[model samples]
Target: MDWMPAEKAIEDVRVIAAPEPRASADLEAQLARALSLRWEEVVLSIGRTQMLSTSRTGLSLAQRDRLVRDVSVAILTQIDIFLERKSDRFTFQTLLEELADEERTSVASKVGAAIADVEMEKSGFRFRANARELTFEQFEATQSKNIPDFVYDSGRGDETTPSDVVAVEAKGSLSRLRATKSRLKNLAKKAYEAQVQAFVGSTANDSIAVTGGCAIAFGATPGNGDCTLRLYVSAPAGGTDSGGAGAAVRGPGLGGARIPRSLSSAANAMQQLDKKHEIERESATLDPQANGNGPGHHRPGRKRRRGPNAHGRIAFANYETVFRLCGAANAALMLRQCLDGAVEREDNPVMQAFYQSSSDDRFLFGGTPFAKCWSPSGYFAIYKPAAEAILEALAANRSTPPDSVTLPELPKDLSWEHGAFAAQADGLTWMSMVRGDFTTKIWNLSSGKW
Candidate 1:
């Protein structure tokens, strides 16, 4: 595909920061339009050339899916960059400053840094601050107590009691800007609860006081896209269990309360294109001629028996398809490890028996390192040995040998390039052993059994 054109389109779309007294509505509009147009072009190209038509580029179905995923990631990365611009009020730093200014509190400056420290430590579940870890018990105790917007030690050796603790609550949205208000409310409740717990654990003096507030950053705008910073002096009394009963505090300046029309429109347009592509794929799958299914001519009662050869072909085809998509180096390494683990494990009687009986080192690998056996042709060679091992084990103890092991049915149109059999990848490592819902035949030897 002509990827350079699309890349250029994305590069050309620039969002200039809005000056004071102006909103970013125009910039958002331009970005939304440019991105949406490029997205439509790319999606339409994939749908028409790859999904709807037969593959002429020699790329497998799995490779096509990976390509689509890569394109989607690129689009999302651009959106992330746009939202992360320094001048945007939706940026994390901007929101913190707005919250501090609204509360007219000196402690707000430290709230952002404290939150950063807690996050970096991965202690959100049990936050560590002030050189100590606060448990859920402490958090619950101060649920009803008033907390400050920012709190810290005075560093004066004379006074040791914890006083005027600041609690900060902040939330931001990139995709779900519309949910900013509700998310902020939820964060506010959580912040209050945490602050209250800290205060209760720190001092017996209830008069020491706690102050705090909530800041919501959202949308592609200067003043955080309709979201405002709010501050609270004390925890609300007898509130709706959420500690939100305090008087509503509003910050200075107008906040963007709604997502810009252009942005939402662009998002909706891309979604529609994706939905359209899905419908087309479904339609193609259902068409018998397109999927390689011949006219029905089978006797109704006759049971079709699939032998080890069929099973092997299906496994080989599915694995090879995925291996090509994931790249030869990574796929070869992972597949070998999966097969090796299955063979070594004592829990899986089928794999254990197969490995013991089979002398073919080409497919079974035996004790040989995968790096030595790695080849484009070697990938195709391993399927039969893997399939035979499982089939042989299934037939060993059963009175009536499983006449045919069911495997995952591939799409009707998919050609095997060899003997006919259907299969799907069960994981990155193994393919389905049989078609149909019979759980016993499925081989996940890497995990020991089906």
Candidate 2:
């Protein structure tokens, strides 16, 4: 599989701004199709790699296949279900609230259980496959504990001992909302603090040890109606500052992105409309025609048609732009985390060797892997490099290059298998391949291994 370039990906996103009924319908179909294709591309690509193929992990080929199918179906089903009942005006929070508890559980469990084999209990805390084992939750004998939405306990295989755990807090929000960066940071901090508290409080039980935490924000972008999954890893708490860890791991926000322009323009346009309405009201009140039978009075010239739904159109465009920007930023952050995690873990000797020889440290963002290979970000990150590569190719092909390009940052920390990387990249590439401007060199690694 080859990767789509960034330019083409942006163009695909632009389709969300297309007019009316066709835009909404096309967006939904594209999302489902893209997600399904990406899922298959990931499975097949990883299946051929020696790293995953020969792993001692209990996941067999059949299990992997089933896992992919079940999880993808669950995700698509939930999305479709949400869209079916969505109102003209709804927020990401609204969608989240509307989803039944069972539906939410299905989404969380399918992803958690398949990737790490974690099981959710009726109590809302997740555990490993073993019955006696319980993933660490903030256990309070008197009151409800502030536990994460999902916890994956990598148990030590000894029932008496505590296992390292990964805690995930799931959140949903509108991509166009204000202060998203702060909101996400706060959410991640809260989840991380709860995990630390649970780890400390559960010392008496000796059941689970908190290793890391993740915050997964599922944002619903309005225009194209696509969902953006942003994953943030919580850094370990340092000193007395509870937020230090979160601050360290905070993902990039939509700074100076085109989203702000869209929002500003929309606001300005709305203000102009409001002023026009106010002027009309005043004019009508002062008009001689209102007094009846003024010979010199003539009907006011018809106001230039602004169309029936001009405001609605502008608002939707703004929402779509914000969603697209946030989604891309989220994807970039996830990819950076994956590359950094793979490099830092030193799981692959080849990757480790490359890191040792590399002079640049910017490639590896400092953080511990929350769930290693099973982390959702790792899978998502696989698509980043390829996407960027394709975008680069497209930019180069243009008669006049773009003033700026927004693409995921390439991972510098690890040596990649050409086929594996290409396959992963293809997951995103397929989306933009229709541009007909890309080249095979987009997948080739020149200069260094990574």
Q: Residue by residue across 270-325, what tens digits does model 2's lDDT show?
A: 47755874563344322222111112111244122111111111111111111122
- Cα deviation in Å at residue 119, candidate 1? 16
Specify the highest-TM-score model's number: 2
Off-target runs (Cα >4 Å) in candidate 1 are 1-80, 84-151, 154-163, 167-170, 177-183, 190-228, 231-245, 253-450
Worst 10 residues of 2 by lDDT: 6-15
Q: lDDT of all predictions, in order shown?
A: 0.26, 0.28
- Residues 330-412 of candidate 1 have per-residue lDDT tens digits of 23223333322232333543332212113222122122211222121111122333333333323231222111122222233
Cα error, residue 281 of model 1, in Å, equals 72
Candidate 2's TM-score:
0.28
